[model samples]
Target: MMEQNQSGRSLLKQMTLREKIGQMLLCGFHGTEASGDIERLLTEVPIGGVIYFARNVESPEQVERLSKGLQHIARGRGNLPLWISIDQEGGMVARITEGISLMPGQMAIAAAGSLEDAYEAARISGLELKSMGINMNFAPVLDINNNPANPVIGVRSFGEEPEAVAEFGVHTIRGLQDACLAATAKHFPGHGDTDIDSHLDLPVIAHGRERVERVELVPFRAAIAAGVDAMMSAHIYFPALEPQRLPVTLSPAVLSGLLRKELGYEGLIVTDCMEMDAIAVHYGTVEAAVMAVEAGADLVLISHTAKLQRESFGALVQAVESGRISEKRIDESVLRLLTYKAKRGLLRMDADEPAAVAGREKDNAMSLAAAAPEQAERVERGDRSHLDVARRISENSITLVRDEEGMLPLKLERTLVITVATEVTTIADEQLVQAPTLGSALADCGLEVVDLTVSPEDVASDSARLLQAAEAEGVKQIVVGTYNAVNPSGDPQRRLIGRLNRLGKPVAVVALRSPYDLLAIPDASVYVAAYESRPLAMQSIARALTGQIPFAGKLPVSLK
Candidate 1:
C-alpha cells in the first residue's frame, strides 16, 4: 500500500505548476450554481474547490448542481477533479442546510452527554455533503473554550473542558470521516481563550509553550488520534513556538516543528482564512503566500482573495524556477492533494443520480430550519423548576453592587421609579402599572416596564436624555431589561448599561439573551439573567423583582 501510494505521488509530480497550484486554492461560490466568469475561472484556473454558505445553497438539488458544476470544471481541466467543501459542523456553522438531519451543535451534544448524538449528527451531515458532491467539511471546532470572557466561541465549543471537547470531537470526526467526507479539526492549536475576534483584528495568545501544552493542545491531540483528514491552524500567534514571529499559519516553527515533527500530524495542514486580518492586514499578499508555502503548509486557504491567489500562484511558479521554493517541496503538497482527490474518488466523477440528490437536498433545508428554533428550547425545557428558581434569584440576588449611600430595597411607598424600553411610544411614555400577578404578591406590589432602543451610537448617547425623560415622570428604581432581546448591548445595551449605572438612582439591569451581557455592564444593583427574553420568563421576572419570589437560581457558570 505504501509503495502504491508512493507511485501515485510520483505521477502527480509530473503535473504542471498551474495544476499543482490549482489544487491548493479553495473559493466560496454563492448561490446554487457556479456560473459565468466563475465557472470559466474554475476551468481555466482549475482552482481546487468551493466552500458553500447557507445563502448560496437552498436545497440538496441546488448543491448537487453546484458540485456537478465544479466537477465539470475539473473534468475539463485535464483529468484532475475538484473537492467541494463546507462548514457543515451542525448547529450555527452548518452550510448543509438543505436536506439533512439538523442536529444540535457541539454544545447540545455535550449537554446531552452522549457521543452517539455527536456521531449521528456528523454522519447525517456527511451523508448530505456527499450527496451534494462535497468531499470535505471544515468542521469539528477543536477549540476548548476555557475563557468565560471569550467573545466568540462560547457554546460553539463542546464544553469548557479540554477532555470533553476531545471526547466528543473525536466521535464527530470519526463519524464524518467514516461517511467518506474528509473532516477537518480546527482552529488549531486553539482559539478558545482570547476575547478578540480574528475576523476583525488579530488576536494574541501570550501563553508560553508549557501552558499551551497543558491546556490548549488537548483537543487537537485527540483529533490527531481520531484520524482526521486535515488540521486547520489558528490565526493566533504563539511566541514560544516561534520565539518572536509569525502566527501559526505562516510559522514554520509551529507548523513544521510542532505539528509535523512533535505531534506527528502527517495529514494535510490547511490554514485558516488567509484573508483574515491576521494574515492580510499585516503581510503583503505575495509575501504571505510565499512564506506560508515555505513555512510547511500543504494547502493554503485564501478565501476572498482572487487577486492574491493569482499573484501567489505566479510567485510560487517563479520561486520554483529560480530555486527559491524547491519543486520538491511543491511536489510534496501536490502528491498529497492528488492522492486526496484519488481517495475521494474525484477523478472518477462518480456522477451519482441527480434525482436521489434532489430528494436529499430538500430534506436537509427543512431539518436545519426546524433546528434553528431549538436554540430557545434549550432553556425552556432546561430546568422544569426554572420558573421557581428564577423567581427566587430575581428577588434575592438584587443586592446593591455598590450602595455607598445604602439607598436600596426601595421602601414601597417612599421610593418612586419607572422603567423604559422599545414598546413604549415616547417620553410621554408613562403608564401607571398594575401589580403583576407575581409582582402584586411582593413588597412594592407594583412593577412598571416601558420600552426604548438600546442600539446605534446615537440612541446609546441619548440614553440619559431618554432615561431622564422617564425620571421626570415621577419615577424611581429605573428597571430596564426589555431591550435585552433587541439590541443586547452591542451599542444600545452598552449605552443603556452605562446610563443606568451612572444614574445613581438604584437602577436594575435585566438581560436574558446571552449571559455574557451581564459581564459587559457595571455590576447592576440588581442583575438578572433570565437566560432568554421570552415574555413568559419576563413575567416571572416581574414577580421576582417585587420579592414575590425568592431568588434560587444558582450561577450556571460564573458571571465573571
Candidate 2:
C-alpha cells in the first residue's frame, strides 16, 4: 500500500468549509490568459481547478502562461496549485491542436495491434502536455465499441473486444501516469452500445446486471485493476443498475454501489460536463451538481458558463450548511483531491505568501521562456517518431474487408475519386463534415479527384447523379470515400456504389472514419477501412490503393 503524504493531511486540517467545497468543483473560464473574471472566480468561489477547452487554447506558449498565471493566483490565495485539466484525447477531440502531434485516436492504436504503440502514444501526449503546464488529461476511453450504431464512442474506444480494450487502456494509463500526467478512464461503467449521443440527449443502456458485468463493466474493472488516477462517470442511464432511471452521474447505485464497493476503484470520481444536454436539459445545473457530488463524484465538471458555476458553488455551500450534505462527505472528496495533487508534487511549492507568489510568477516566466525552445525541440523529436508509428500503423490498419473481382491495387491512371462529405459528430452534438481532401493524397498517383457534398436529405440521388456524370466522361474506376456512413446514413453511399457496380464500373469504398461501413456497403468491388483520416492515414490509403504499400491492417472490430 502507498503511504499517505503528510502535506495533504496537514493542508486538509487547515482548510475552511468553503475552501473544501471549492476543491470539489472543476470550473471553466474563457481566454488563453487569466482574466479579471477568472481572478474573481478564484477569489470568490476559489475552485479546485479549471478545465480547458478548444476556446481556451490559442498556442502552446499561451497555454503555459495561462496555467502558470492561474497557479500563481491560487498560491497567492494560499491554496494548493490548481489542477489544470484538458480533454486532449487526440484525433477528433484534441484541444491543443497547433503544437501537438495529431494521433490516430484510440481505435487506430487498437487497429495497429501493439500495446507498445498505445503506451508510446500516451507517453508522447503526456510529455507534450506536462511541458505546457497541464497536469491532467481525460483520455484512454475504456468503453468498448461493441455496437456499430453507437453515436459518440465509435472510434474513441480501443475496440469491440473487452480484452483488447483492457490491454490498451492499461498500457495507456501506465504511459500517462509514468510521465507524471494523471490519466482518467472515462464514462464508466461504459458509454458504448448506445445509439444515442449523450451530448444532445440522454442514452439508456438496457443490459441486465449479469450482461452489464459481462460487457460494459469489463474494461472499467480492468482500469481499476491498472490503478487509474481517476474515473469519469457517464451521463447515460442504465436501468439495470438503477431502476429509478436516474443517469449514472446522479445514481448512488452505480457510482457508490457499483463503482466504489463492487468494483473497488479508489481514485477520484469525476462527473462529465454538467452543461451537456443529458444533464442540463433534464435538471437544473445546480441541482445536478449537488446530486453528482452526493452520488460520490469527487469532482463536478462545469465546462462552460460562469452563471452556472456560481450557482453550483452556492448550492454546494448551502447544502453543506443545511445538513443536506455532510461535512464528512466533503472531506472525503477533498482529501482524495489533495492526495492526488501531492502525489503530482503540486503541493511542493515554497511558503504560501504574497511575496512568494510574485517571486514564483517571475521565476516561472523566466524559466518558461528559457524552457520553450527545449520543449519545442522535444515535441519536434517526439512528433517525428510518433508520425513514423502513425504511418506504420496506418499502413497496417487499412483493412481490406471486401474485394470481389480483384479490384484493389487500383489502376490509378484510369480512376475517378469522389469524396462524399457527410456529417460526422466528433467533439460535439453538432455535426461537421469530414473535410480531408483525398485528391491531394492521390494527385501524384494520376487519379482524377472530384469533391461532392451530399446532404443527408438527398444523398442517394445526388451521389448517383454525380457518379453518372463521371461515367459519361469515360471514368471506369470508381473510388468513393465516405465518413459517418456506417452508423446512421450508410445506405445512400451503398446505393451509389451499387449503382456504379451495376454500370460495369469497379467501385472501391474507403471508409474514412468507421471500419464497419463495409457492413452497410457489403457489395462494393473493394473496401478499405482507414479508421481515421489523419494526413498520414490518408497518405497510407493512397499508397495502399496504388500498391505502393500493401494493405497490412486487420479488422479490430468484426464486421460480421
The CA lDDT of each predicted structure is 0.61, 0.78
Cα shift from native, residue 130, model 2 (Å): 1.4
The CA-based lDDT of model 2 is what? 0.78
- For model 1 the TM-score comes to 0.69
- What does candidate 2 score on TM? 0.90
Count of clashing residue pairs in every prediction: 26, 1
Candidate 1, position 342, lDDT: 52
Off by over 4 Å in 1: 1-4, 29-31, 96-100, 347-491, 494-514, 521-558
Worst 10 residues of 2 by lDDT: 364-373
**lDDT tens readout by residue for model 2, 1-560:** 13334445555666678888888999888777787778888877778889888778878878888888888777666555788899877665667766666566788778778898788778878887887888889988999898999888887888889988999999999988877888999889899888888888899989899998988888888888989989999999999999797999999999999999988888999999999889999987889999998999999999888889999999999999999999999998988987787566565423232122222332211011111112333445246876676566667777787787798787744566777654546444222325456656776556765545455457776875776665775676777787777755567776777777787877788888888787787776588888777666778888888888887777778888
Worst 10 residues of 1 by lDDT: 364-373
Q: Write the per-residue lDDT of candidate 1 for residues 132-225, one digit (tens) a residue.
A: 6778888898887767656556545776677878998999998888777889998988988987767656789899889899888998999998
Instruction: Compute the lDDT of residue 522 as modeled in candidate 2.
Output: 71
